[model samples]
Target: MQQQEIKALLSDMSLEEKIGELFQLPSYFFNGDMVTGPAGELGITPDDLRVSGSCLSVVGAERIHEIQQKHIEKHPHHIPMLFMADIINGYRTIFPIPLAQGCTFDPGLAEKCASIAAREAAAAGLHVTFSPMADLVRDARWGRVMESTGEDTYLNGLMAAAMVRGYQGENNDFSKKGALAACLKHFAGYGAPDGGRDYNTVELSERTLAEDYLPAYKKAIDAGCALVMTSFNTLNRIPSTANRRLLREVLRGEMQFDGVVISDWCAVSELIPHGIAADEKEAAVLALNAGVDIDMASPVYLKNLKELAEQKRIDEKQIDESVLRILTLKNKLGLFENPYKDGSEADEKELLLCASHREAARDCAEKSFVLLKNEDSFLPLKKGKESVAFIGPFTDNQLLYGSWSFFGDEQDCVTVKAGVTQNYPDADVFFAQGCPTADPGTNVLGFQKTPPKEEFDLQEALDTAVELAKKADKVVLTLGEHRDYSGEGASRADITLPSCQLELFHKICEVNPNVCVVLFNGRPLDIREINQKAKAILEAWLPGTEGGNALAGILYGDASPSGRLSMSFPYCVGQVPVHYNHMSTGRPFAGDYRTTRYNSKYLDIPNEPLYPFGYGLTYTAFEYSDISLDSDILHKGDSICASVRVTNTGERPGTETVQMYLHDVSASVTRPVRELKGFCKVFLEPGESRVIAFPITEDMLRFYNITMDYVSEPGQFEVFIGSDSTTSRKAVFSLC
Candidate 1:
């Protein structure tokens, strides 16, 4: 329905009916104590007060039907509640965590995961999934990093669009049998919280917000996401839920996002804490004017929206617009058509945990493993070579299934020990717990860092692992942050491997240098110390349900590790804001630091990252040569073509990702040293070579101008073609 028509209908309604449209009753109706529904003192009985609609929780088909029947009976409009849930990763067939999914560098996989998650959610009677968190997370110190795609704006935008398409489909209708409404959450600058802390203040320049933060949300909006959730943090000095410039000018006006804008949980109430609104009435007025369509889990809007409308404090048209959006989303879900549609109940809870879903999870688990280093082919441990010792707290534990895993069952998840036993039935496989993941922060200065209490002993586990490593022919040392280290509200001050585990690996390598280190981490880590001693380093980034099988497959050469680091692997945390796309400093550094030259360089470590974004190694080798550009100068809208010859020089067939980076040597505003423009992935057999070609145009070269319009600047551009971020062949070009 059009806003004008909804306004006409709402204008004819009484004050109580207008109030009813603004209120979203709690689903706590199922939790008993359902006297009134609104706040404590100003409550009204269910029979007395008229509720326009409600928000519900999904339990089962029969239960949903019961609630729908009861809810419709109370409302004269017969409006049904919108059922919502935090189905982030999956509803039934859980895949890898979002971070791991991002590592695959394949939007198809993310889309597929979203499709499955949507399917299961719709089947279970869920109308909306609060997901596809398009927040561009730069700091791995944020606990919600696991939920975000990664640090890059373009990559996050692509994945966000893909996931929104997967969830809501090309059409925004959720009435379809396999569709659920997509909610692009934490709407503006939620990722850049102070000190990478969740729900903290976000102080950033307007250009930074437009250039870095807002693009992903725009992508989600373009993909036709049904709803957008306001972030908890304040942007600049104003709360995002109440920021008119962010929600109105930017999101609705500039981006033309017509979908519903919902407040984050209790975020409307937080406007008081943000000191923007004096009370609930002012908060309601601020949020409504800011274009927040629905107030979630906050009673401020329910309490004051109608009174504001009646008193002309808020435009009656705005109230109707917000209500219409809420009702429209419900209508889109076919809730208004038939709120109790799924009446059929079956014995399918067992079928929810199917083998096909598990297999898909396994495929993703394997594909997401990144091989950081494989010196001298120490990997692909032959079927029956020598004794292999698997050591660490997570080597055989099923709890390593990362965070935000809704459907990954501990019983169903495959452990490394189980996988190894299954792969090499007759081979000698030794197991050790190693040290506790959380350890005492004992230092040489005799200062002790208190450790979180765990159920296991630290020294015994380490001693047992060391003893086993001494006897084994080869040792597979698995180490990383505990599963709880990177999920929601689990940010760490120091993003390094646990001190004890690092020490353990160093000691174990001293005893035996044949250590194959498998890192199971939620986010990037500083593992430079272990990288030096470990013969092979496999980054198994919190692989989900079939993780063990995937690990065994990669270790035994059943599959090649093709995943690249979506985020940079920092050598240390001091490089907190480090990225390849950093703006060029006034004086850029060159050559080694020992020359005593004053330039933009770090004193101790090289400016280079430990492992650049898109950097990954395989057991096999691929060579890049023969770079050519069609034209050095081209007119606007003219295409410039380039190609490079890639050859597989190893015995085994593998996939190689050719990355194309562009550098605008000079621009109005300082540009990044390098920016990823395009990429292509291809598979090759042993001794096979193929010519990879890419066509670049003005669109690929566009940047936000002083007027905030996206346009390409006339400049000398350097094009690079290579295997990863660091190594490439350069060719110069100019646009005329």
Candidate 2:
């Protein structure tokens, strides 16, 4: 529909109808019965469903078709209801979680997975996906870190843009059958909650907010993301849902995001509990005025918007503005022309979990496994030459898909035991459940319910595993946090393996000299103990449906491990918010502990992480030469070429990600010790060498200054080019 047509439709809508378009309810509200149970308790009535602009978390093509058909028939304006869900990674053909995808360091691959997810989701009648979470996370204790593309702002922005493109298709053209509108969330520093707690206060300076958190969302918006979801946290003492400075002035104005803004699940009404609003009416008024176009799963908009407008307490124009944006999105999705857009039972059957998608998932899973430790080159195990003992809870477990995979069933997932059997049929493979992922009485903290108890005696399981370990030539000890341990509202105080699993690991290590640990988890864990004990460690972070096959491929030499860490793995839980790009302090730890104790250093542990960001290992070793610069000076509007010769020194094919980092020696504000500016991935055969070059431009050096100005100060900058953030290969250049 054209602007004139949408405007005319808006002009014809009754005040109640326009106001209703701003409320998004769950699917059950439109089931042709009075809203009952939990949904009914929200004060939502059958009449509210008839005029609601969209439905949340609705699935199945047939169900969506039925609900949409019924909705349009009763809606006074006949505006089609938008069906939205949290399709973060994949719909049915589950891929790696966003954090794992970040480890791939391949934006193009991320885009491909998102495209496949969009295809599967659109077939199931989903019109919008609340995904491509652009939050920059540093704390591993925050369970939702699993959903974010790790700590770097640049990488997160790049991946966010790629996913936005993948979901919306080229040029935001939703006319394509498989394309679905993408929504970037949770807006404005949702990842940096105080104490790493979910929905906690986020107090960031305006400079830090723009310099780190806001760029990723802006990148997604610039890539034509159709909507933005307000975060649940309070940014700088103001609830994000009602922060006019954040939503209106910064988001819509500075970011130039014209997309429809929706509140995070019930965040509009949550303003009351946040101490910003007196009641639901005030909450609705605050959110609506603050530029939230839709109130998701909240009663604030439905119950008070109309009354507030009638009483002149709130402007009716706010309702019109929001309703117009909602209608614009519907038109962009081509829903006006076809209410049940691309939703077909046959399509859902053919598209979801298809062979091609599984193949893609397997390939992506292969690339996402970060080989954190490969001591003595113990991995890529010789198949027929050794008897392998697979010991742990995840050895045959199918719960590989992490949290927020609402539609993915565990039965369809392949197990590690099954993968080995299928890939290496002749190998002598023994299996035992050494220990459960967690103890039966363990608290998962926040919304995740207690998982079913494992019916096994602890002593018996330990004895069985130890016996297998002693008999076998190699012990593949699989261990990790339970799937329920990470994701929204699931923060943890201890980011380490459970005590039971640790005990099992110790028992196995005592019996077997050659032990390989494969970790299945969501967030980066404190693996200091595992690092010291295991001969080899593979960080296979909750690989999805093809997880088993992917791990087997890496273990048996079918594939090479190339994934790098997007977030740093800390030495212990005490280092909760560690990252590579931390600001330089006056008394920085210089790593020469013998020199002085007065510097900014921990007395018990090193300030550095156990594994820094961009750290990974492959079957082959890559040697980097000294960094070379084309010139010693970089003037305005000119570029400086920084080059390094990388060679595959080891005896197998591998992929290496060469990272480029820069440090601003002096600035108006304290800068990070080293910031990742750019990186490139290269595949190399043994004895192959290539010289990679990166152009250093002034635009890449710009940052938000103390005066809130985004500019680059001319100074002498140091550049480091090598494997990871801790690389010491450096060259100096002056930016004039």
Candidate 3:
């Protein structure tokens, strides 16, 4: 239905129905915290779902069916409440966390994972998923890095589009199985938190917002996402939840997004803390007038909206528009036609975690593993090795799937211990919990809040790990952030392995020179020490459910790790803002010693990251040679073909990501030192070679032009081909 038609329908709504459309409490409201109004006249009984036109939680099939049925019986308009849940990663079938999925560099898999998640979630009565967080995360210290698609704009955009397609599918049909509406969340620059702190202030120039932050949301919007969730952070000193320029001017006007704009949980109320609004009433007025259509978990809209409309502070038109959009969303969801339509279908299922879902979970986990470094053909560990020591806290812990993981049983998840045992029942495998996840200084003072200690004592655990390593032929050390390190409200000042763990890693390496390090992390981290000590490094980003089987498969040559780094790994946290594509400084790096020291280079560390973006190693070796270009110059509407020969030199089959990058020698505005234009992943057998090529046109070179118009400028461009951004062969092209 057109929003205008829905507005006419809302004109006939009673005060009760209009107020109902304004408030949407959290699922905790029904399951736990029951709020009563001061007068006790207005509220909902826990057992009475019928009177509640909108609600938040829907756990299992049974509760969903019961709550859904109850709502159908009571609502006067019989409009069903939208069943919403934070099914961020997966519903019942968990996949690798978003960062790992991004590492796969496969949009098809990203979409497939979301589709499976939607299928399981929709089966359990979920109408919406606050997912595919389209925030462009540049800071790795932010705990939410795990939730984002990584630091690159183009990569994040691709992942966002894929996720939306996966979640929403090709149609708006919710009756069939596919995805529930994919909520493009934390809209705008929430990822640019001050000092990488979660929910901190984000002070960005308009150009930075447009170039770096806004593109992902724009891409998500273009992907046909039905809803958008505002951020909790303040943008330009205004809380995003109440920013008119962002919600009204940019999102609705410039982007032409007509979907429901929902505020982050209690974010409307947070304007008080932001010091932008006087109270909840003022916050509601600011947000509602700014084009926020839904008040998520904050009752301020219900409390003051009617009064505000009556006083003419907010026109009835604004309220009606908001309500109609929401009602339209409900109608599109088929809730109006069948509030309890398939709510009962959840109970009809015999198994929630079936074989197919688990298989998909395993496949996702397998693909998300990225091989970072492997010297002396150390990887694909020879089957039936005499003995191996599995050392780390994560070796047995199943909670390493990161945060917001649903429907994945910790006990059922494949731990490194279990996987190794299952994969090689005959081989002797020693195990040890190297150290506690928590820092010692912090843990001692926070005993009251901390969980009970598990495994061995911290020092003893490290000692045991070192001792066990001495007895084994090789050491397979699992390292990196624990489950609690990243996710909601978890940010870090230093993006490095905890000192104690680093010490343990060094000790294990000392004990057994033949060591393979498998990182179980959420986001990219500084790993200079690990790079020096370990002969091999693998980034296994919180693989969900079947993470163990996947890790074991990579270890035993059953599967090859092809995933690449989506986020850059800094040598140290201070080297942040270091990406593959960066604008060259007026004083570029000089080759001379004196000039290099004073130029745009850090005194303590190199400007380059430990591992550049698009950098990843594979078990088998691939050689790059024979670069060819169709033309040395490009004209208007011309496409340049850049081709290269990629040959697998090792005695095994493997996949290689053939990347193409471009550099602008000089332009009206400085361009990135190198920009990723195109990439193709191909599999090759030993001694087999293929010519991989990419065509680049004006569209590929277009940027926000000199006049602030997004267009391509005629200029000299350099094309590069190699494994990553930094190490590549270059050829110059002139655009005329």
Candidate 4:
């Protein structure tokens, strides 16, 4: 539909009809999932579903087409309902969680995964996916950390842009079966909730918000994300859903994001609890005026917006504006011409979890596994010769899809035990359920599957694992958080492995000292004990459908481990937030007891993370030469280059992520010790060498200054190019 047509439609909508469009009723309004919406509980008739702008979590190609057909028949304007779902990491052919995908450090691979998700989801009749969550996370205690790409601002923005491109394509074309609209979520500072608690208040300086958090969101918006979702938390005492300064002034006015702004689930109505609104009516008015176009799963908008408009307490023009944005999105999605866009049962059956899609998942899973510790070359296990005992909670459990793959069929998931058996038919592979995943009563999120798939008695489970370990030459203990432990509503104060898992590990290691620890959780864990005890540790991180195959593939030398840690793994949970790129401290902590006095060091534990960001081990080893700068004095207008010769010194082929870091010698405000400037992945065979050059343009050094100027400062800068952040290979150059 054209602008004139949308304007005419907006003009034709009555107050009640317009109010209906703002309400995104949950699927339970009709699906019997739960009793929700005005139609279900507030005495509104079934016809209320007709004008509802969208439906949430309703799936299936036929079901969607049926709903749209019935809705258009009842709606006066014949505007089709938009179908939206949380197609976060995957729809059916699940891939590694977003964080693990970020570890790949290959945006192209991430893009391919997103493309597969978009294709599978669109075929199932999902018009919009609330995905490409562009939140920069530092705290591992936050369960939602699993959903984020990691700590770096530049890396997050790059991944966000790649996801947008993968989902929506370059031309914003949704005409194809795989293409669908994407949404940038948790609008502002959702990742930095106080104490890393979910939905907690956030208080960040504007400069911090602008420099770190807002870049990823802007990149997604610029890449043509069709919508933005308000965060559940308040920003500086103002709830993001009702903060005009953030939604209007910054997002729409400065950033020029002329897209639909929707409230996070029931966020608008929660303003009463936030103490800002007197009632639902005030909440409705505040959100609308603040530029929230849709109120998802909230009663305030439908119940009060029309009444407020009639009383002149709120201008009807706000409703018109909100309704206009909704209409524009629908038309742009080509729903105006064909409501059943890209939704076909045939396509859905053919695409979801197909061989090709699962292969992509496996390939992606292979690259996403980070070999955090490979002491004594413990990995690349012998397939047929070694007697392997894989005993743990996840040995046979198919709960590998994590939290967001709501539609994922667990039965299709490959278990680690199964993968081992399949890979080496003759190898003696012993298995046992070592322990319960988490401490009892930790699941506050009300996880659906009442009986966890696998559980074992404390002593019996351990004794059995140890007995099996004694019989085998090697022990592979798989353990981590339960399925209920990490996701949107899940938050943990202590990010540690469960006590039962620790007990189980001890029992197994008592008899069999040569053990491989395979972690299967979402976020970075306090693996200090496991790292010290285990001969090798693989951070599998909720590898999806082909998880078992991918895990075994790495263990059996089918693929080399290339995934680097996007987030830092702490020595303990006491260090709630830890990262590699921190601003320089006046008294930085120096190693050793004598040097640590009067410094920014901890009383007991070291300030250093257990494993630094960009840290990973591969089968092959890469040697980095001294960084060479093109010139010592770099003119302000001219670009300088920092080059390094990287050689694959160890035998075997592998992919290495060559990362470049820069630090300003001095500035008006202190800068980070070292910031990741640029990185590239290089695949090398043994004895192969590549001279990688990072062009140091003035723009790469730009940062928000004390005066809020986003520009570069002319000064001497240190350059370090190597495999990870802690690399000391360095050079110096001066910017004139």
Pick the lDDT winner. 2
In model 4, what is the error at residue 64, expressed in angstroms?
A: 0.8
Instruction: Give candidate 2's root-mean-square deviation (CA, Å).
Output: 1.2
Candidate 3 global CA lDDT score: 0.79
Q: Per-residue lDDT for 1-736 in model 2, tens only?
A: 8889999999999988887889888766645544566557777777777888988998889999988898899999788999999999899999999999999999999999999999999999999999989999999999999999899999999999999999988888975899999999999899998899999999898888989999999999999999999999998799999999999899988989888999998999899999989999899889988999999987788899889988999989888989999999999888989999989999999999999999999999999999999998899899889899999999999999988888899998999999999988998989999888897687665577676689899999999999999999999998998898899989888888999999999999898879999999999999888999899999999899999999999999989999999999998878878999999988888876555699987778888899999999999999999999999899989999999999999999999999999999999999988998899999999999999999999998999888878999999899999999999999999989
Clashing pairs in 2: none
Best by TM-score: 2
lDDT of 1 at 620: 88
Give each model's whole-structure lDDT. Answer: 0.78, 0.92, 0.79, 0.87
For 1-736, candidate 3 gives per-residue lDDT tens digits of 4556566667777765676676775666555435464212334443333334456665665677677776666666656788777777787667899988988888888988888888777777788888889888778888888998887888888899888888887765655554588789897899888888888999887767887788888998998888899999888888888889999899999999998888888788888888889987899889988888878776678778778878988888887777787888877777666665444453336335678877888888887888888988778787776688889878887875766675566776788888888977886788888886655654312111342366457877788889999999888888887666788777777778878788888888777898888998888888888989788899998998889988998888888888888888988889765677878897887464334666888776777788888888887888888578899888888788889999999888988888888887887777888877778889999999999998978787877756777787877889998887776588788888
Which of 1 and 3 is ahead in TM-score?
3
Per-residue error (Å), model 1, residue 561: 0.5
Q: For residues 212-261, write the lDDT of model 4, one tens digit per residue.
A: 89998998888889999999988888999999999999999988998789
Determine which window of 10 residues in candidate 1 has minimal summed lDDT: 442-451
- Candidate 2 lDDT score at position 701: 91
Q: Write down the TM-score of every candidate.
A: 0.93, 0.99, 0.94, 0.97
Off by over 4 Å in 4: 32-40, 440-442, 446-456, 593-595
Q: How far is candidate 1 from the true structure (C-alpha RMSD, Å)?
A: 3.8
